[model samples]
Target chain A: MIFTIVVVGGVIGAIFFIKPVPKYYTRYGVELGTNVQITYATSKGNAKQVVDEMFKKFSDYEEIFDPWLVGSELYNLNHSDGKWTKVSPVLLTVIKDSIDFSKLTDGKFDPTVGRLIPLWGFNTDNTRNWHLPSPKEIKDALKHVGYQNVEIRGDEVRLLNGVWLDLNGMMEGYIAQMLVEMAKKNDPNSTGFVDIGGTIGIIGPKNGNEPWIVGIQDPRGNPNQAIAYVKLYSGYVGTSGDYERYIIVDGKRYYHIFDPKTGYSNDYLESVTTVSTRSIYSDGFGVFSMVAGEKAMKEMAQKIGVAYYAINENGQVIKSANWNEYEYKK
Target chain B: MNTKNKFFSKWDLLLIVFLVAGLGIWIGIKQFSPPAAKAVILLDGKVYKVIPLDKNAYYKIYRGDTYLMTVETKPGAIRATYSTNWIFPQTETTQVSVATGWISKEGETIISVPNKIVIYTEGSKERTLYDAMTYQN
Candidate 1:
């Protein structure tokens, strides 16, 4: 009888002591042309304030980064008519990082391919009418597609030969990093995550023990299905996949990750996902790997000291040596 | 008499076994249970509506009664149809065919960005693909 009472008391104590931590989630739709979802665990219950501030910061960054927006700093720089244009520090930093990535990937990840984006109708929201650009048009766009054409001296950026800069490839990751920082700043002890589109950055570990599990979308599967999952404790994960935005014509798929060499979408990869300590590198490398293919992606992952998972056009999944370490096994 | 010999008595072992069994059963129920079928609609970031997935019904969603779209829910599945919203500032109309496909699984989302509408299915077993997903615009 005493033993039964002790066991009952122990069970009751365990149930009370092991209370589940409350987690707050805020989902904001249609911010910066994509959805933003933030999840945080904090005793202060200030998730709404943190998310509001993050969205406000996103608005500020969009004004600086959006090249198509008429009043954006990038738009002004693009229309500067071969003259040196003073840019914001954020723009300058991202541009410099873009150029560095361009060089690092041997122009596989060029920001100057902005001219080619519209030539193939990728810049337009109307993808229904998207078509292949004429060879002449592609050739003409190619003339302006070189990262070297961008001249940056301090805060002033100049486009030699009228090369337009598109930071779309790297902007979301940067914004995600900023949002994560905002979450941490709002409450240092808080644990959370920020997902802008598909680029993700963790503010800290979830539930204070288990790493955050993220699913990699299957290129051929339905929107909700993941080919696999990766566990993130902190840092960022960015995926570039043709399946997300693509035009199908005559059984051929054309998506927006452009190859500066051909002024067309690279046909090598279906998707590439990069995990890195820094959001910028994760964004840049994911795009780079999509264009560079499997062998180069593996080498780059090793050289850059980041984890990567790539799916080829044949739908074969490839992973870096360390990628399995981050896999969330059921 | 050494106290170590009495440290794990039959009662202690029985208690541990019961605790472990209870935890296993809880985890099993949590992981393997089929999620409750429901479709959550969000308009401009707030929950616009939540429809049960167990019944056949058609719901007309509107932005101030403008009749933006119709959502069809069947037993265990949901889909969007009859959308007339423009695809942003561009010339193309929002294609209902793209949004018309049935979404029954967890984590599946149907989004019409131009209309500021998002529809996602949820269940107890529906797991998020990632803590967050980042993709190109």
Candidate 2:
């Protein structure tokens, strides 16, 4: 009887003590004019299905948010010509959030600079065709470039000054947030992340113990190179840099991140990366820091309670007071 | 001598051996299995192909019959080569070079936005520096 009990105990221990390792699934696709990658860990083997549904949701959101797309909600609103356009609630929410960010950054992160984008030939297909807009054109475009010109009531949005709303900066973060929420809803126990372009939203911790390691792109190096790595368990990370979409004219590099005040690309900083509990804040603050430069970035980051890392034109690395806390030591 | 018997009998020893052997085999299988390695290629956000990294091979990636580039692979490594396609009116090539050559260890990638192609390695043991690389718009 003693022998039989010992054998049964051993069998039960063998069966019950071993835990199945969680399987990781990664899916990649292009949406919203950039690469979208979703990586998640789940023991139930439903990551692919979950990610597929998320991508479909992303497409629906893109149609509402993408201004450059001809029939998109924002596109229709932009071409509405002083009329109050009925927009999707998602668009309304994003526009409202963008205006708040503009106010927070003192118009440094204006989405109303949509007119300037085309003037700089950013809307065109070929970067070789991109040129500096004439001062007269710049002045004319700047006339319509103020976030205060936007008015929203219920689901109707109007550009009061005939200004266009460009939600590019804020939309990525919002989408990231939405994807994170979807992932959590699908399986709260699953761990993973959603990366829309460079805007990243964390689902949860890796294997419930290890934090996700995110690398900051080196401003002077290739796309795959990293200057530093940040360890994060949750929240969002967004980066704006001069290297990605820039044209060199007469030895001067002109990037796409524009300053509302100057009506041109800001050259004060090479790159700015922001980390926040909210993805929209990360996205907005990154663009704000790029336009506002290092000193203002520090001040704004402090006021808004976000961590930031900035690389100046002189290649000097600047970090917020709490920035080092996120750095991965090993 | 005829009346004597051991408290710890042969049956106990047999049970202990069986348990120990079973646990050792289970642990060995869990820890020693080699992870499968593969190169995942994405074209415009969708998985274009997944190629095993264990063999030598060559693949020419194209978008709608327009030849983009060729990727050469060796055991456990991959590289991009001979991209003859021009990016529209620009004089620059597609600018996807693995000329620094051969990304074998996982997490390394070769990407060309103009061609909308991305190639990266994936494996169980592989670690990546970033969850994703963000570029300036």
Candidate 3:
């Protein structure tokens, strides 16, 4: 009877003794349909003040640092007379990064393809409208999609031809990373994670003492089954998939991630997720790996320092060497 | 104390448990978990072989005995991957000095070994193998 009482007492003790993780939220709805979300997990720390400061610094959509709103500036720059404009500093850096990616990918992922996106009517909203791009139409848009057309002179930016720059792929991941870093800067003990769209960034730790576990959406969410999941912490996780944007034809489907060579979406792989220290590298490499397909991805990852995992159409998981070391759940 | 007060007063007991658990985890993490390895596999340096696949589950065996890592094949051996080191010395674009050429001396240029991944050209008599690529244990 005494032992039973002690056991019961121990059970109660375990529950009461644990320190509850505290969660704080900071969110702002910016202009131009842009939104930012930041979450901070603390043991005994408060991050409200720090997070507010970060939001204020990053909230100026019209300023020289915001990357998301700069797409509008690039849009206007290409439409104006052939002259340079004092563009956002962050946008200038983003364009430089995109041009670098275009060179690295051999024109595979060109950011200057802004003219091509609206032509497909994807800029507004696209879930149903899918059509074949006529040869004449594609040729006209292709003229304005080269990386060499955009010139970056220090803080100023210029468009050589009528070309637009779109940082949609790089912006969300960068913004998520920026917010996480800003929170950590004020409170060294800040332990939290941010998930935007499919991109994920973790600042300190997940369980305050453990690596944060992230769930990857299964490409096929019919009855809501996870195709596969990965564990990510202290890094950025970016997933580019065929499911994001696609065109479904008679008994078949097509997607947005295009291969520049044939001007069509790839047929080999379904999704590719990359993890890296830099959010930019994670964003660029995630899309590049999908475009490179299975065989090429392995070779590139071996050469590059970034780690990644890929999911093929068959739902099989292909992981880089140390994937098992990180605690991954389905 | 009432039954409700008895439960509520358990904070004193809980505080001790919390500190002990937190300290245990803190010491455990600092004591046990090694830093994340930069180069996933280090070869031609310190030699450590995994005789058992149970504990050393995170290492890939390239060569030698210490780190004996193998792929999970229900029926057989692994099908060589591009990034992995292979038995058929890869001389592809990524692997520069890997030789597809067979060196011969005594009896013949090539010979076939059953139960092993074989290599041979058209009308060739023998197969050659120096190594095999393996996954982390």
Identify the leading candidate in terms of TM-score: 2
lDDT ranking, best first? 2, 1, 3
TM-score of 2: 0.85
lDDT of 2 by residue, B15-120 (tens): 7788799999999987887657788888877788898887788998888898877999876777887565333233221243543267766656776555667788
**TM-score preference between candidates 1 and 2, better one:** 2
- Residue A75 error for model 1, in Å? 1.1
What's the TM-score of every candidate structure? 0.84, 0.85, 0.61
DockQ (C-alpha based) per candidate is 0.28, 0.35, 0.01
Better model by DockQ: candidate 2 vs candidate 3: 2
Top DockQ prediction, candidate number: 2
User: What would the DockQ be for model 3?
Assistant: 0.01
Candidate 3, overall lDDT? 0.53
Q: Which 10-residue window of candidate 2 chain A scores lowest in summed lDDT?
A: A121-130
Which candidate gets the maximum lDDT versus the true structure? 2
In terms of TM-score, which candidate is stronger, 1 or 3?
Answer: 1
Q: Which rank order by TM-score, best down to worst?
A: 2, 1, 3
Better of 1 and 2 by DockQ: 2
Tens digits of per-residue lDDT, candidate 1, B28-95, equal: 98887766778899988778998988888999988887877788889878887656653332322225
